[model samples]
Target: MGLIKTVGLTKTYNGTNAVDGIDLSIKEGVCTALLGPNGAGKTTTLNMLTGLINATSGTISFDDRYMGDRRKYIGYLPQYPKFYGWMTGEEYIIFSGQLAGLTKKEALSRSDELLSLVGLSEDKKKRVSGYSGGMKQRLGIAQSLIHSPKLLILDEPVSALDPIGRREVLELMKTLKEKTSILFSTHVLHDAEEICEEIFIIKKGKLIIEGDLVELQRKYQKPTIYLNTEEPIEDWSTTIKQKEWLRHMDVKKNKITVTVEDMDMAREALLTDESLRKLKINSFEVAKTTLEDLFMEVTGK
Candidate 1:
C-alpha cells in the first residue's frame, strides 16, 4: 500500500469549494511535491490530511489504515508554526515527543537526537523566540520528527528563506527522504524541480496535473530555439510565422526566439534558411523548458 493516499478529497467554505476532489498517493521513501499558486487549495488539502481541519468529503489512509487510526504515524510541519516564546528549542521538541505518547526519558532522548539532526544541538538551550526564521524552521522539522512518523507533511518548507537557508533546508529534506515519505507543498517551482520525484499541480482548487517530474516535462515542454544575430531581418517576425512548423516566434533586440513542435525539423530549417544565414547569426541554441514554464503553460498565464 502507498504510504499516504487520499481519494476524492474536498473542502468547501461559504458555498465555494476551496479544495475540489484531489486524489493523491504518496509512496514510501519518496518525495512528492504539491505545487500551486496561492488559493490553489494546497494548504487546505494538507490541513485535511493532518486533521487540522475535517474534509467535507473523501477518505484518507496512511500505511493501509485510515488516517484517524494512524494519526501518530504522520508528522506535520505547518507553515508559520506558533511555538511558546518562553520554551527553549529543546523544551519545545521534548514537549512534542510527550504529546506523541513518548515517556519522559524517551522524549528527552529523542529531543537531543532530533536537535542534533537539524543542526540545532548547540542552541538547544536558546528560546525559540531568539531563533532566526531558518533556525525556527529547522526546529519545527525536529519537533515533527520526534515521534518518528512514517510520513512527513511540510507546508511551504522554504518559502521565506534566503538562498543559503533555502539550500540548507532543501538538503535536509532530501536526506530525510531516505527514511520517511515526504509530501511538501510549495509555490517555488525550482525547489520542486530540485527534490521531487513525483509532483501534483493544483489550480483554482482542482488537481490539474500530476506525474513524475521527467515525464511531465517531456510531455508538455515546448522546444524553443534562440538566435542571436548582428543584423535584424526586415520581416523577421512575419518570415518566422510563415513556417507552418513554427508554433510561435518572438523577436527582441538582436535575438529571435522561435517555438516549434519538432525541434529537429526546426534546427534543420534554421540551418538551411539563407535569410537567417545572411543576417550574420552570431549564435543559436535550444532552450530547455523549466518547471516555471510548464506551470505558466498549464495555468495559462
Candidate 2:
C-alpha cells in the first residue's frame, strides 16, 4: 500500500464543495507534485491531509491506519510560514523541536543540524526579522522537519520568493526529497518537472491528470519541428505545406511550427530538401509536447 492514501477525499464550505471527491496515493520515498492553479482546492486538500482542517467527508489513511491526528507523521509548511520576529532562527527551530517532544539537548543538536541543511546556518543566530524571504522559507522548512516526520507537505514552497530565492528553495527541495517523502503544491510546472517523480494536477477542484512524467509525455506525444527565421521568408507557407508528412502547421510572428506523425522522418525531410535551405534559419528544434502544453490543455488558462 502507498504510505499515504486519500479515499474519496472531500471538503466543503458554506454548503459548497471546495474539494470534490479526489483520490491520491503517495508512494513511500517518492517526490509528488500537487499541481493546480489558484482556487483549485490545493490548499484545502493540503490542510485536510495535514489535519489542520477537518474534511467534511471521506477518509485519509497513513500506513493503512486512519490516525485522527496526522501531525505525528506529517511536517507541513504553508505558503506563508509565520515566525516570531523577536526570535533567532536557531531559537525558533529549537523551540519547534521541543514542541514536537524532543528533549532540550536533542532540540539543540537537531536545530543546529537542520539550520545547516536548509542553508540557514550563517543566519541562525540573527533575529528572524532580519532574514530575507528565502531565509524565512528555509527556516520554515527546518522547523517543519524538526520531528523527522514520515511525510513533508509544502504549499507553494517557492511561489513567494524572488528568482534567486526560488532557485535556492527549489534546490533545497530537490536535495531533501532523497531523505523524505515530499508532497508539494505549485503552479510552476517546471518545479514539478525538476524534482517530482509523480504528478497530480487538479483543475476546478477535480483531478485532471496523474502519472509519471516520462510516461505521460510519451502517452501524449506530439512530435513537432519548430523553425525560426531572423527575417520572414515570404514563401514559408508554400514551402512547408507541400510536405505529405505535415499533420498541421502553426505560423507565429517569428516562427513556424510543424507537427508530424514521425519526428525523425520530418527532420530528415527538412534537412535533405535543398529547396527550403535558402531561408535564413535562426533557430531550429525538434521536440515532443511539454508539460506546459498538457497543463494548458487541462486547465484551459
Candidate 3:
C-alpha cells in the first residue's frame, strides 16, 4: 500500500463541492505534483489533508492506518510562507522546532542539521530581511524540515521567483525528495516534469488524470513541428498548407505551426526545401507534446 491514500476525500463550502470525491494514493519516497488551473481546489485539498480545515465527507489514511494526529508526520510550506524579518534564519528554524514540541536542545541540534541540509548554514546568522527571494524560500524549507517529518508538501514553491531562483529551488527539492515523500501543487507543468515521478492533475476541483509522467505523455501527445524564417514570409500560410505531408497548419504572425502525416519526415523535408534556402530559414524544429500540452487538452484551456 502507498504511504498516503484518500477514499472519497471531499470538502464542501456551503452547498458547493470545493473538492469532489477523490481516490488518491501517494507512494512513499516518490515526488508527486498536484497540478491544476486557477480555482481548481488544489489549495483546498492540501488544506484539508494538512488538517487546516474539516472535510465534509471522506477519509485520509497514512501508512494504511486510520487517521490519528497525522499532522506531526507532515511538513508543509504554504504558497506564501510568512516569517519574522527580525529573526536570523537559524533562530527561526529553532523556534519552529520548539513550537512543534521539540526540546530546546533537540530543536537547536535539529535546526543546525537542517540549516546545512537546506544550504543555509553559511548564512544562518543573517537576518531574514537580508535574504534574497530564493534564499528565503530555502529558509522556509529548512524550517519545515526542522522536525524531520516524513512527508513534505509545498504549494507553488517557485511560482514567484525569477528563472534563476526557480532553478535553484527546484534543484533543492530534487535532493530533499531522496529522504522524504513530497507532494507539491503547481500550475506550471515544467516544474512537475522536472521533479516529480507521478502527476495528479485536477480541474474544477475534480481529478482529471493521474499517472507516470512518461506514460501520460506517450499516450496522449500529438506530433507537431514549428518553423521560423528570418522575416515573415509573404502569404506563407497558403503555401505551407499545400504541402502533401501536412495534416494541418496554424500560421501566426512570426511562426508556422504544422501537424503532419510524419513528424520526422516533415521536419526533414521542411529543412531541406530549396525554396526556403533563398528565404533564410532561422529555425525548423519538431516539438513533442509535453505535460503542459496534456494539461491544456484535459482542461480545455
Candidate 4:
C-alpha cells in the first residue's frame, strides 16, 4: 500500500488542464522522483499533494494512519524557497518550527538537531543573507524537517545550483532518504537515477510512466556497447554493418555506439575483428539502457 495516493488528480487554469487526470502511489521509506521537462505540471501536482493548492477534480489521500489535517504529515520545500535575510539559520528554523505549532522550547531543541542533520550546525549562527546557494538550500531542508513530518517533499532542490552546490545537496539527500520518505521533483535524470528507488515520469501534464527504477531499467533495457577510439571508426563500422547480430550502430567522430541482437556473438565478433585490432581503442564498455535513454525514448526528445 502507498503512504500517499492520488486518484485522477488534476488542476485547471483558464479552461486548460494544467495537470491532467494522473494517478500516483508513493511508497513509504524510500526516495521517489517526479520527473518531467519544464512546464509539465510537476509543480502543480506537488502543490496539491502538499495542500498548498486544491485539486481541481481528484482525491489526495493519505494513509488512514495519518488522520486530521494532511499538512501535519507533510514537510515541503518549494523550488524557490524564501527566507528572512536578517534571520540567522538557527533562528529561521526555530521560527519555522513555531509556525508549525511547536512550542518555543521544542522548536529550539529541534532546530539544533535538524541543523546538525543537514550539516549546517557550524554555520547556524550566520545570517541567511551571507550563505551560499547550497548552504541556503541545506537551511531550507532543515526548516522543513523541524516538524518531523512523515513525508518530505522537495521541488527541484538542486536545479539552480553550481556543480559544487548541486553535489553537496545531492549527497545530503542520499543521507536523508535513509531516515525519511522523500518525494522530490527534478528533470535531471542522473540525479534521480542516483538516489531514487521509484520514479514517475510526466509529460505535457500527463503521467506517462511510473514504476520501480531498477525494474523499469531492466524491462526497457537493450544490449548495447560503446567504443571510443583514438581515431575515427566510420569505415570500420560500415564493414560490420551487414552482420546479423548487429542491430544498429551510430558513429560520431571517434566514437561508435552499437545495439546488438546477441551480446555474446557481437562481443566475440568485435573483439576478434582484424580491423578493430589495428585501431588504438581509447575505451570499450558494455552497458544497458540508462534512465536517460528511457526518458528520451518515452518523451520523444
Which candidate should be chosen as best, given TM-score against the real structure?
Answer: 1
Q: State the TM-score for model 1.
A: 0.89
The global C-alpha lDDT for each of the candidates, from Candidate 1 onward, is: 0.87, 0.87, 0.85, 0.91
Candidates in order, TM-scores: namely 0.89, 0.84, 0.83, 0.85
Per-residue lDDT tens digits for candidate 1, residues 98-177, read: 88889999999999999999999999999999988888899999988987888899999999898877987998998898
**Model 4 superposed RMSD (Cα):** 3.2
**Candidate 4 wrong stretches, greater than 4 Å:** 226-256, 264-286
Lowest summed-lDDT stretch of 10 residues in model 4? 289-298
Model 3, C-alpha of 267: deviation from truth (Å): 8.3
Ranking by TM-score: 1, 4, 2, 3
Model 2 lDDT per residue over 1-301, tens place? 8878898899988888889998999988999999988899999999999998988998988884635556888999998788999999999998999899999999999999999999989889999999988889999999999988889999999999999899889999988999999999998888898889999999877888998877886787788888887766446657767678888787776688788887778899888766556666777898877778778768876
lDDT of 4 by residue, 38-77 (tens): 9889999999999999999989899889999878889899
Which pairs of residues collide in candidate 1?
none
Poorly placed runs, candidate 2 (over 4 Å): 65-68, 227-256, 263-285
Q: Candidate 1 lDDT (Cα, whole model)? A: 0.87
lDDT of 3: 0.85
What order do candidates take by lDDT, descending?
4, 2, 1, 3
Q: Candidates 2 and 4: which is better by TM-score?
A: 4
